[model samples]
Target: MVLILIAMQFYSPTKNISPGNHTQIFIKETNPSPNLKALFETSCYDCHSNNTVYPWYNNIAPISYWIDSHVKDRKKNLNFSVWQNYSLDKKDHLLDEIEKMVVQAEMPLTEYTYLHGNSKITDKEVVEIIAWVKQTRIIYQLGKQPK
Candidate 1:
């Protein structure tokens, strides 16, 4: 088991590091308030964005793979770094999902908060995020409507 573990360390998954300001377009387009932006950077950006601030344990084998898997899955679901690429309809749907996830406390996954306590989303933050998602959804929906 020890040798296997050691071998695993040699094959680390590719890190999700993007060059330049990947979130810039998302920030400008979404126009979230400063507080909301801070909340997002603190709680959601790690897995949901192109850039991830890896924890110390991420250097370990198997654990690195697990963390990388989670990050990939999250980015697959909703990558804020590529937000500007989504269609209006997709944006509206994602906003709806965000609101639902926040209200249900299904985001900032428990495992994430366990390791990074500061990443935990408080009840107040949930309310704020949900409200912002609803407001943002309206904008996306408006854009979807034909002139």
Candidate 2:
């Protein structure tokens, strides 16, 4: 049991780090709304952004590993931290997906919410996020790339 427990500790995940300044530049260029920015930072940034604010307990092995997996999966699906890198069409599609996920209450991952209770998405907040995502997508569709 002791050995097994020790082995489990090694399974913890590590936090993500920014790959480059390009992602920062991307966010600066896009200029998301204050509300949208707060929503993303609070709910999505940990996994989807280039800069992850790791909690102290994340230093543990098994938990850290799991968190790392979540972050990897999030980035694979849609990395808002690196948004500017995507083509306008791709970003628009991603925003549509974001709206869909938020509307369906399928975001911020349940496992995440269990620990970070405050990260839970409220229905009203979901509506706000979805609306913003749709608006952004429309902006993209209209050929209004963020300056």
Candidate 3:
């Protein structure tokens, strides 16, 4: 077990670092309020964005793999950095999912909040996030409608 653990340390998963302002389009297009932007950066960006601020534990073997898997899965589901690539219907669906997830306290993953307490969403923050998501969904839905 010890030997396997040591070997695992030598092979780290590729980090999710992007070269430039990958999320710039998303931020500019969404036009979230300052507080909302801050909330997203603090609570949602780590796994949902192209850039991740890795935790110290991420350097450890199996833990690193676990974190990598989570980040990959999150990006697969909704990558804010690639927001511009999604269709209007997809954007609206994503916004609806975001609202549902925030309302149900199913986001920022429990494990994530455990390691980063500040990432935990408060009741007020949840309400604010859901409201913003709903507003955003309206815009997407309008875009999806026939002219």
lDDT for each residue of candidate 2 in 1-147, tens digit (9 for 90 to 100): 888768878665545876555246545755667766666777888887777878888787667777788788888988876676788788888878877877877888887788777788888788777667766677778885555
Q: List the residue pairs that clash in candidate 1.
A: none
How close to the true structure is residue 61 of candidate 3, measured as C-alpha lDDT?
Answer: 89
Q: How close is candidate 2 to the true structure, as a TM-score?
A: 0.79
* TM-scores, one per candidate: 0.95, 0.79, 0.95
lDDT, each prediction: 0.88, 0.75, 0.89
Between candidates 1 and 2, the lDDT winner: 1
* Predicted structure 3: clash tally: 0
Could you arrange the candidates by TM-score from highest to lowest? 3, 1, 2
Local lDDT at 110 for model 3: 92
Q: 2 in model 1: Cα distance from truth in Å? A: 2.2
Clashing pairs in 2: 11-61, 12-61, 12-62, 12-64, 12-65, 13-64, 13-65
- Tens digits of per-residue lDDT for model 3, 1-147: 999999999999998888888789888877788888888888998999999989888999899999899999999999999999999999888888888898888987898899899888899888888888888888888887899
